[model samples]
Target: MADSADPSDTSKAGRAGERLAGAVKKAAGSVVGNDALRAEGELQSEKADATKEAQRAEAQAEQKREEAEAEARAEELRVERERLAAEDTRQEREERAEADRQTEAQRAEAETARKQESVSQATRAREQETRRDEVEAVRERGEAETRVRDEEARAEQARGAARTLEKVEEEQR
Candidate 1:
């Protein structure tokens, strides 16, 4: 079976027992009026007191060391948390900047597309106007040609009549 007693607790108990025994011995020596026994008891009591004081000092030192270590760990955790938070903030900023850049690029592309469409529409309108003008000119030229041919035929008929009249006049004479 394992011993359940802690060493530090056992030592403390042993010191307490020594202090009690010393007190009993001092009382017995005083009752019996023995100087040697009284001196021995006093010495034992002083030794026990000194040992208890030393143990208390050691325990206090151990507690202080543990407290310091705990405080250091807490500080380290605080610093780590702050670093992570800063990293997250930086990442968020980058993402937002990228999103803004994409939005601007898309807006620019849309504007360019709109301008191209406007230019194409203007080109088509100009082409239609030019074609209409050419067709009108062609029609005017065809009409002018037909009029010149009619005039030539009428002149030829007039000359033929004149020649026939001159022949009749000579025969009558």
Candidate 2:
């Protein structure tokens, strides 16, 4: 691949180099009848493969997180659109009611009371919808955070395993 500034690209190139070097070492060891050198080369190639797999898994997790966040934002926008539509409807009703009150002065008090009740109901409904959206957003954020933590834990485990293998190789040497 052509050189790029992306870290993933760098990592991919590095891993490829490691595998190539490992193959060379393994071949040289074989020619010299050296078991230790061959073993080390095998370990190096395996480590490179493991790191590549881990990076792939992490990229997948990050994609999933981005997708989830996008979904949440879309939902919030939909809710906001609905709320605005509702507000417009409420405003239209209020305007019509006001016009009626001006013509029917005898029923003005009752109309005002009814309008108050209608406004209260709309307010309560809006509050409930707002609360529900907030809860959903919080839940989505928590899930995304959990996924990130899990990925981190997996990466750490891979590192630990690599370190343990290195220690064993040292002991063998």
Candidate 3:
């Protein structure tokens, strides 16, 4: 099997070779007093440094982006919890209100039953009063009839006594 070279590794090796060549040129230019060759070598070195700094900055930016994403997820979870808590509070309020309504209904029913009981008691008392009045009237009528019969008997006895006295006076004359 043939080994395939990775493109990223090839690029990194190429950069390293260029840096070595630049260093050699800088040393040769310094020994030979060639100003242009020294300047070219310096330019190559600066380019490598600039490329490394740019890569570092890019890595830092990626890390910052990842941290921001994590923080956003945490905030989302906190908001979800708050929403659930609010829902729970609303349901509890509804349950309490329903319980209060049921209690009120029961109270009203009890009040109605009490009123009915009071009416029933009043009716029974009226019936009792009517029975008492009927019994009193019957007793009064019996007493009046007995008094009339006694008065008639006494009048008849008085008439008989008067007749007897007249007969006795005639016999004496």
Candidate 4:
């Protein structure tokens, strides 16, 4: 029977045997009609049972407390993991936002450069057109001056010819 009995059960049986022995001793003293001894034996049995029950209740309470602590630790770890994950997500979002901002800035800069280039090209074109107009004006003025000089020289030559003819008739007469 000892070989078959679990250690915890054996310990409980040993405590029970001790309680039984005390009760038997009190009962034997009461057999001669000693009422006090019988009453004392019953009281002792009640006390022993009460003590055992109290011990059992204490063990159960301790076990429950340990289980509660384990559960609390698991919950805390879960919350921490969630917090870390949220932080990572927030960081990722911030990085993406920063990248978007950079891209927008670059695009705006490129647009501004393109506009400036167009404006510069237009300014150059205007300057070239103005120079061409000035050259044309100068050429037209030179052509007009040449025409006026040629007309004056022709008139002087005709006057000289008429004067020579009048002198020659007068000499001949």
Candidate 5:
């Protein structure tokens, strides 16, 4: 893993050194009248330039590799985040569904309780009505018995008054 900075710095430095060496060789060749040495120096400079270009290419390739790795890492992080978010959403939905189920159960329980209460109320009402009917029937029977006794007493009193009137009439005669 190479640090992603200026990859051309080393190549530029190498190029500068090569240029300086070529210039010195050219100057020495003019002073000593040596063509072969000057030609050799030019070839050496070309070789140095080629080496610099190769280094520059290698550095560029390294930089591109680092960029690619960084991109891959970022993509991986993005995918992981998405996965976590989906998991959270799923959990939330599950929780909501559970809550809804609990609510429905509670509602059903409340309805059942209400129905039971209604049935109890109805039973109590029926019992109260039955008791009232029994009381009314007893009162009616007592009233009928009292009426019968009063009628018998009246008939006996009428008969006794008639007998006394008949005896008084006979004594007067």
Candidate 6:
């Protein structure tokens, strides 16, 4: 449902025509020296002028409204873009923090591994030292047992020579 009168055309031409007719009538009345006709024509012209002024005012107000609406829409878009940018910045920071945390965890794990390897190497060195000590002690014990057996054999030979000498002397006597 559209109105027959379009808003774009506010009938300024119609008001102009009325104003011309009133001017013509006023000039004819003045030539004839008719006071009433001249007065009526002047009033009509003034009325037409007032109507034109009112229409102009209305158009200006409508333009202002449209401009205000456009400005509001632009402001809304700007605010939305700013919010999205802030969210993007926050997300980027969170991602970086998470990456840093993961890197730190990896570093800690590597340090723990290094420490464990050092402890393992120390334990291995101690076991080797203990094994060497045990071997040396066994060798020393074997050497001591050999010296004791040699001394016992030498003592038994000396006792046998003494007994044989005593028997020879007794037989000679």
lDDT of each: 0.59, 0.61, 0.56, 0.56, 0.58, 0.60
Poorest stretch of ten by lDDT in candidate 2 = 1-10
TM-score of 3: 0.42
- For all predicted structures, in order, the TM-scores are 0.38, 0.41, 0.42, 0.40, 0.35, 0.40
Query: What value does the lDDT take at residue 74 in candidate 5?
Result: 53
Instruction: Specify the poorest-scoring 10-residue window by lDDT in model 5.
Output: 1-10
Candidate 3, residues 19-117, lDDT tens digits: the string is: 544555565566559988878766765554454455445645655675576557656655655555566677785665566557655765675577557
Candidate 6 Cα outliers beyond 4 Å, as residue runs: 1-13, 90-173
lDDT for each residue of candidate 1 in 37-75, tens digit (9 for 90 to 100): 767767776665676566456655665675576557656
Which residue pairs clash within candidate 4? none
Q: Which sections of candidate 2 miss by over 4 Å? A: 1-12, 90-173
Candidate 2 per-residue lDDT over residues 23-119, each given as its tens digit = 6556556656898887877787676567656655665666567557655765665565555556667777566555544555544445556655765
Tell me which of candidates 3 and 6 scores higher on TM-score: 3
The TM-score that candidate 4 achieves is: 0.40
TM-score of 6: 0.40
Per-residue lDDT of candidate 4, residues 62-166 (tens digit): 556755765576566556555555666777856655665576557656755775576567557645644553454345435544654576678788889989999
lDDT of 5 by residue, 75-120 (tens): 6655655555566677785665566557656765675577557656
Each prediction's RMSD to truth: 62.5, 21.2, 63.7, 62.8, 61.1, 62.5
Residue 102, model 6: Cα distance from true site in angstroms: 37
Clashing pairs in 3: none
After TM-score superposition, the amount by which residue 104's alpha carbon in candidate 1 deviates from its true location, in angstroms, is 2.9
Which runs of model 3 end up more than 4 angstroms from their true locations? 1-11, 90-173
